[model samples]
Target chain A: DAGITQSPRYKITETGRQVTLMCHQTWSHSYMFWYRQDLGHGLRLIYYSAAADITDKGEVPDGYVVSRSKTENFPLTLESATRSQTSVYFCASSEQGRETQYFGPGTRLLVL
Target chain B: DQQVKQNSPSLSVQEGRISILNCDYTNSMFDYFLWYKKYPAEGPTFLISISSIKDKNEDGRFTVFLNKSAKHLSLHIVPSQPGDSAVYFCAADRYNSGGYQKVTFGTGTKLQVIP
Candidate 1:
């Protein structure tokens, strides 16, 4: 509805396959972020976009790719998914500054 | 090297008691701190935040205390209820010289409020 939403709440894919997680925010926030949550490690930022066409890599960005062609949408793509990529993916959006963020329900991905 | 750390992996408290979750950070440049609560199969929602300049910030039953000298922050929930059971994550906002802002989150502490 009015908040952020992620597509395919649950996904199962094979290793080496490509998977893309979609994130859409209705609030029209200027900053969109992608984070992955694992067991020992907390939520690590994968990528963040300040505005349309402006993106930056976060802590763990080696295996992930992101693009923000539109302000309302930011998609994360895994070129070659591996078993280590299996984790809960979250999408968040915020205003100009990177202070408060609203998160989506999250997408659970299992790479077999 | 983890910048943010939540030493307590899990905490249990009886209902109507106080629940304390602690977080520590190694970066002194982090100016802002925030706490987020996440339920199973759901994204984390912002709970509360306190700037480095302030020692304490409170909202209703939730209060966040920041100790800048010790580089520690804590979230205290009074009169805990079952609904308060969730994973709480503490995040630090760091602004780099490049004019970019980044958030570093701790491993998270799972709190179970026994009702």
Candidate 2:
């Protein structure tokens, strides 16, 4: 219970519906990241937050929106889910930039 | 384009033998590199890492070798065991990537240890 945790480890949603993946870390790390893992693409960063109210887009952030209102939580929302959005989402946290990150179990989202 | 590349999709090695997993990078600005191992239903955990300044770094049975000139790196596991079977990802740190210190990861290589 001391490490990072993601809500709804498995999710099923219809296309065009909105889905939000929640990530909470108890460590209060300075940097939080969201990544999606897909076949042939590995893990691509979708968004990252340096601290509360500070967030930036990553490699593939077009279809996703992220917000960090609290230091302990960073949530990712898919405005209009599509089949291409079906992938495993991971949340990671680090104390500093370019440091070792601790990851959560991951949330598997399927868009039908 | 993929900044980090792991050409091998999977590899099988006999138990007690050495297992080699390789990675290549296209970016010359990467100053740090890391390897992560992941099992099904679990998040990836850091395995080992080496700085561009050093050619090698070792921890227990895991060792990471970085060749800055060739833009290549590798992870070698000695006495490979069945427990070592998992997906391994190589990551590179782009420190100057807009202050975020973005890490580009390879697709990953799955290693299987046959007894």
Chain A TM-score per candidate?
0.97, 0.98
Residue A13 shift from truth in candidate 1, angstroms? 0.7
User: What DockQ does each prediction reach against the true complex?
Assistant: 0.84, 0.83
Tens digits of per-residue lDDT for model 1, B1-115: 8999999999999999999999999999999999999999899999999998899999999999999999999999998999999999999997766576688999999999998
Supply the global lDDT for candidate 1.
0.94
Fnat for model 2 comes to 0.77
lDDT tens digits by residue: candidate 2, A15-75:
9999999999998899999999998988898998888999988899998999999999999
CA deviation > 4 Å runs, candidate 2: none
TM-score of each: 0.98, 0.98
- Kindly give the stretch of ten consecutive residues in candidate 2 chain B with the minimal lDDT sum: B94-103
Mark the 10 consecutive residues where model 2 chain A has the least summed lDDT: A94-103
- How far in Å is the alpha carbon of A16 misplaced in model 1? 1.0
Candidate 2 clash pair list:
none
Going through the candidates in order, what is chain B's TM-score? 0.98, 0.97
